[model samples]
Target: MSRAFNFCAGPAALPEAVLRQAQAELLEWGAERASVMEVSHRGAAFEALVAQAEADLRSLMGIPDDYAVLFLQGGATQQFALLPMNLAAPGQGADYVVSGHWSQRAVAEGEPHVRTRVLVDAADAAGLYLRAPEVDAAAVDPDAAYLHYCHNETIHGVEFPAVPDSGAVPLVGDFSSTILSRPLDVARFGVIYAGAQKNIGPSGLALVIVRRDLLERAGQPRARVLTWAAHARAGSLLHTPPTFSIYLAALVFAWLREMGGLEVMAAINQRKAQRLYHAIDDSEGFYRNPVDPASRSWMNVPFWLHDEGLNAAFLEESREAGLLALKGHREIGGLRASLYNAMPEAGVAALTDFMGDFARRKG
Candidate 1:
């Protein structure tokens, strides 16, 4: 059977070429006798793998040398708790801008560790959840440890065109859903983290690129294991790293480079999003996207059917038509098409064709 276009928000699609290469090299990576998963991470080959991956990432994002890149475990969800644990001193608070479900979850998780001040909530805009809120940087507490936000709210289908300008305060961002989709000025952010599943590679590995100064600030009462300084100093070789996932991500980075890097990827991503959003807009009320047009996400596009009853049928038909994972997130009972870096333009065209037929028949 042929592969279907997978639209899952995370654990999403990976490049076909990368997968094929992995299959070819699974038994022996170059001259090594073992698979990357079977090899010791401390070995020279794996060490080179780690260094190259970091170098590629640094080049792609133009990350400064002063920042340390740590690939840790526990996913982005873990970082929600770890961020506050590391950044927020006991009584010192931090600002959380709730733009959607993920950011709200981050606030909820961080609240126990620190006094969470919700700086902005954009839930009511266009009936969507997290979005780029109308926030005034001056409103945030000057003494707050840092400002945290989710750059792209996956479920709510909202994102910021650029990082929010929060003055002197360090900006921490959850870039899980949208990382590597486009170019970014890494220096603009104090800390940026993302789960590898979305645009990177697979689950189990989470990448955190943090400023060296922030690591010094994570002086928690807990053991050093939770601190970024510990991990960075140890070179992210802590506790048997996710060797396979990291290797896969490295392959993905190489694939991106072969395909002309993030600049070209960004252009393709923007075009793919524009095609689908245009389809939604041209449908004449048959389909609607709830996000504010200006703040809509290029990575994930969530649209609703005019008739609620057709939801199940739409998903079923889409599946039968070889489109996989068209179902929306449970929190939002509508279809969401996540056009991540791995999803091809052909898939978007196929989906638009399906939407056109479904709308003509149902409308």
Candidate 2:
């Protein structure tokens, strides 16, 4: 059977080239007689694979030598608690810019560990989550352990076009939805983390890039597995790690490099987003995207039809047309299209065409 265009929020689509390459090497990786997953994590072969994955990722993102790139188990949800445990001292507060569901959850997870101050929240007067609010530099507490924000809110389709100003406080970002889709200034952040299921490869792995000096702040005596210092010291080989996920992620990094790095990827992603958004904008009140124009996400586009009754027909016809996973989150019912790095321009074009046709038939 042919592959369909997938728009899942996570465990999302991966590059076809990466998938094919993995298939080719599934049984025997190079000269080794065993698959990558079967190999020992401490073995020379797996070590080399992990090292090369880190190197390629660093090169693609322009990660500096002072940063420690960790391929860790558990998803970004684990980082919510780990961030406060590692970065914040007892009773030390951390400023959080709550824009959407994920950011709010991060705050809730950190509250028991440390005092979480809401620097800015994006909910409107009606308490509806619509867009990311502008960061007020004056509201940011200078003495906070760090400032946390989500680069892109996958559920609400809100993205920060620029980094928030945190003054001297270290900036921590959750880039789960937007990582590798564009060029980023790695120096601007003290720590950046993402779950691999979206743009990278598969579920069960979280990638963390943290400045080396900040490792000293992981002073809280937590479990060995939860400490960033231990993971970094062990070279992310602590307790077996997610071998298969890391291997797949390595293949994806290689694929990204071959696709001309983030610069080329950014242009392609921008074009795809523009094309889809144009379709929504030109729908003549038939489709509406709730996010503010400035904060709209390039990765996730959530829209609602003027007549809500047509949603089921739209989804059913879209599935028949080979477009999968277009349903929006239950919290905010509508439709969403997740345009991650792996979604080709042709896929977006097809979706736009389908949208136009659906509107015409139902209008």
Candidate 3:
């Protein structure tokens, strides 16, 4: 059976070549008697796998030696609390820039733990989830523990072109969808966390890259599992880690290395995004993307049919055509095509063809 083009926002598609490689290595890896999934994380083979994954990822993202890369479980969602617990102290506050659904949820998660300050407010704008409000750098608290923001608002289909520049405060970025899609300045962020499902590999693993100085800042009173320092100290092997997910992520890193790393991936991703956006543009409001052109996310593009009643039919037909997960997030009722790193150009072409056909049929 062939693979369907998946546009899922998260727990999303991975590179096909990576999957095929894993299948071949499922029973045994590198002539070893056991699969990567079956190997002990403490064993030398798995240790090398994990280390090599970090090193490859480090090179791709230009991660400096001053950072610790942790392959963890609990997804990026868990980092919402873990970050506040570890970084934000009792008296100090953290600024959260709320651009969309995930950002609002992140603010709520961090509120109880510390003094939560809203940086970018978009609450008054009706149905404008796709545009991030312009941030005022002067208004940011210089003494704040960390400034948090979602690099790509998955639900809203918005993205910040560059990381927010808040003076003296380390930036904590939730890069769940856009982690490896482009080259990133790892040094700019105090911490960056990403779920493995989207651009990296399967679900169940979250990769967190934290600056060494930030990890050494202070420890919390919670269980050892909750502290980034504890996890870092154990080399992300504290207790039973997500062995399978980590291994798959390693495979993906290897595949990325083979494809000339992130620089090449960025170009391909840009071409794919431009093609899809052009399709949306040519529709002449027959279908409309709500996001501001500058703030639009390359990973997920949500657009609406002028006739809302046609949504169900569009999804049904799209599935039949082997285009899957084209439904937008429920909170913002429209269609969303998450063109993650794994989505091939042909898949986007098929979706564009389907959209054009659907529009004509509706008309």
Q: Which candidate is the best by TM-score?
A: 2
Best by lDDT: 2
Candidate 2: the clashing residue pairs are none
lDDT of 3 by residue, 1-363 (tens): 568888988889888888888888889887569887677788888888788888888888899999999988888878888888899777778888888888888888877788899977665546466576776778788878888888998888889987888777888889999999989988888999988888988888889999988887773567888888988998888888888788888888888888888999899889889989998889978898867899888998988888899989999999999999999888987999988878988999999999999888886
Over 1-363, each residue of candidate 2 has an lDDT whose tens digit, in order, gives: 699999989889988988998999999998889898799999999999999999999999999999999998789998999999999988889999999899999999988898999988889988777777787777778889999999999999999989887778899999999999999999999999998899999999999999999999855668989999899999999889899999999999999999999999999999999999999999999999978899899999999999999999999999999999999999888999999999999999999999999999988
Q: What is the C-alpha RMSD of each candidate to the true structure, in Å?
A: 1.3, 1.0, 1.4
Off by over 4 Å in 3: none
Residue 157 error, candidate 2, Å: 0.4
Q: Where in model 1 is the C-alpha error above 4 Å?
A: 125-131
Worst 10-residue lDDT window, candidate 3: 121-130
lDDT of each: 0.90, 0.92, 0.85
The residue-level lDDT of candidate 2 at 177 comes to 96
Tens digit of per-residue lDDT, candidate 1, span 128-228: 57458876889989999889999999988999977898899999999999999999989888899998999999999999999999888854577777888
Superposed Cα deviation of residue 307, candidate 2 (Å): 0.9
